[model samples]
Target: MTGPLAGIRIVELAGIGPAPFACMMLADHGAEVIRIERPGAKKGGPGGDPTKDILQRSRKTIAVDLKSAAGIGVVHNLVASADGFVEGFRPGVTERLGLGPETLLKVTPRLVYGRMTGWGQEGPYAQAAGHDINYIALAGALHAFGRAGDKPTPPINMVGDFGGGAMMLAFGMVSALLHARTTGQGQVIDCAMTDGTALLMSMIWSFQGQGLWRDERGVNLLDSGAHFYDTYVCADGTYVSIGAIEPQFYAVLREKSGLSAEPAFDRQMDPRGWPELKEKLSAVFATRTRDEWCAILEHTDACFAPVLSMAEAPAHPHNVARGTFVELGGVVQPMPAPRYSVTPTVAPRMANEQSDTEALLDGLGYAPDEIAALKAAGAVA
Candidate 1:
């Protein structure tokens, strides 16, 4: 608790994916986040090893069986102490659990209640089961991916889950918390992945509206439709990315790549010539190893970068120098971003299961016997 949000406390009803990621972001920046997991849920869920669940890092965890009244009571007590609360259940799930925003906001008038969902709280698809891909598909983000005449590509879960869902929830929570501090009133934030994903595509939609972008995928300038703004495979089967969108940078790419003399490259802005130019650039890039290309263009304004794999990214010279990654709890993971010069972040810690229950309860002023009775009643594990 050393970053900008050090004094804030959040109670997270631990679920999966986006919610965990949002809580992690808050915890990473020095908020005291307490994750409430189900008593009998599997350890780490799909994150494999609990310690290596990067999304669950930087927070304390308490295992509570919300089905039990005593467990619900425990959450109510935590809410009384917390400045904010986050849950990612389907629209009505929290209401059934007796932990809905209406109930919790009454306990803590200044609490910021955050709800993360794929389709939002009142949409027709709100109760429908879906994943990140489905959320982005509905948001019109999925259709923007992939080349012409190819099936739409899902950009893993980043666009929908993290960018749209979690990040938006975090921002909403913080903003709501600021308002709560001034007015002593709590509010619910309905963060839908679909809504956030569509927001992320605002610039693209603007391009389409202004007639600067085409509806087809892979035919747009930023969507790998242009020769200068796409990934190219190297001779060694590795890859590199280029984003020479400007004429100056494109000229530099032409000179460094020895394609300056090629007459076809002169018509860089001609839509009809893009496919042919892309073919020739592909052939040229395939002649060099990825590292060799990096050596020639990486430091220049060619808008170039070698497509480093996950294993290779942390070891890159620039990343290492910037301390972009750090080793914590014997695992290498990304550090808290958007560094603050006045109030720097503390190192992230691994999630501990039920290890903080007693201490957390004690901090809430529960007697030892009371906590023991809570455990005995199967309210907390």
Candidate 2:
């Protein structure tokens, strides 16, 4: 607990995907996050061990049965001591559970209440059941991610869940917390995945507005249309990405890849010649193995990088040199990101449900008998 957010305390309403991810970011940077897991929570259950769930890392967990009045009271008490609260339930779920902002605000006026949802708190689709794909699709992000003549591709939950939903909630909470510190006032943040995803498309939207981009998929400069800005399969069937958009970098790609003399590639920015030039570049790239190309272009300004698989990424020379990944509890996962100069982050620890429950309740001033009584009442697990 020694990073920029060292003194912050957050109460997380345990859920899946984005909610946990958001808290993980907060906790990684040294917020004291207490996760409230539902009693008998079966998430990552069966063969799914909680220790191996990377998203649940770097936090303490307590299991509370929200269905019980005592459980509701338990969360309220925590809220009073906390600086921020995070929940990803549908719009009205917390309200129904008696832990809504209106109820909690009375106890702690400076609490930043963060609500994560797919649609928004007040929109027509706020109550609708949807996942990451559906959320990004509605945000105009999904329609722009595929090759020409191909169906829209889902970027696996990254674009909506982690990028849009989780990151937005984390930022909202931190910003609101700062505001509360300054003004002595807390606020509710309705962080919608759809809105966040749309915000992520701001640069692309601007390109469209300026007539520098097309609405069609795969036809834009940053998409797969530019031969200089796409991936190519090598003779070994492995792939490498190129983003030599600038003329100087593109020259390096041409010289390093032996495509300098090719006439079709002469007009680098001509849209009409892109398709034919792409075919020629593809043929050239396929002539060499990925490793062979990496040797010549990997260190150059060609903006070149081999498309390493998950197993290979951690072993890459640059990543190894930077300590971008770490092994914890015999599990290999990414280290906390956005490095700090002072008050660096501690390595993440494994999550254990109810492991800190007794101590946490004791800190909340629950007598030993009162804690036993709550456990006996089945309000805590």
Best model per lDDT:
1
lDDT of 1 by residue, 191-295 (tens): 999999999999999999999998889999999999999999999999999999999999999999999998889999998999999999999999999989988
The C-alpha stretches of model 2 lying farther than 4 A from their native spots are 45-47
User: What global local distance difference test value does model 2 have?
Assistant: 0.91
Q: At residue 165, give the lDDT of candidate 1.
A: 96
Model 2 steric clash total:
0
Q: Tens digits of per-residue lDDT for model 2 on 1-381? A: 588899999999988899889999999999999999887767443336788788889888888999999999999999999999999999889999999999989889999999999998987898899999999999999999999889999989999999999999999998999999999999899999999999999999999999999999888899898888899999999999999999999999999988888776889999888888889889989999999999999889999999999899999999999999988777789999889898898678877644578899999999999999999998987
lDDT for every model?
Answer: 0.92, 0.91
Quote each prediction's TM-score.
0.98, 0.98
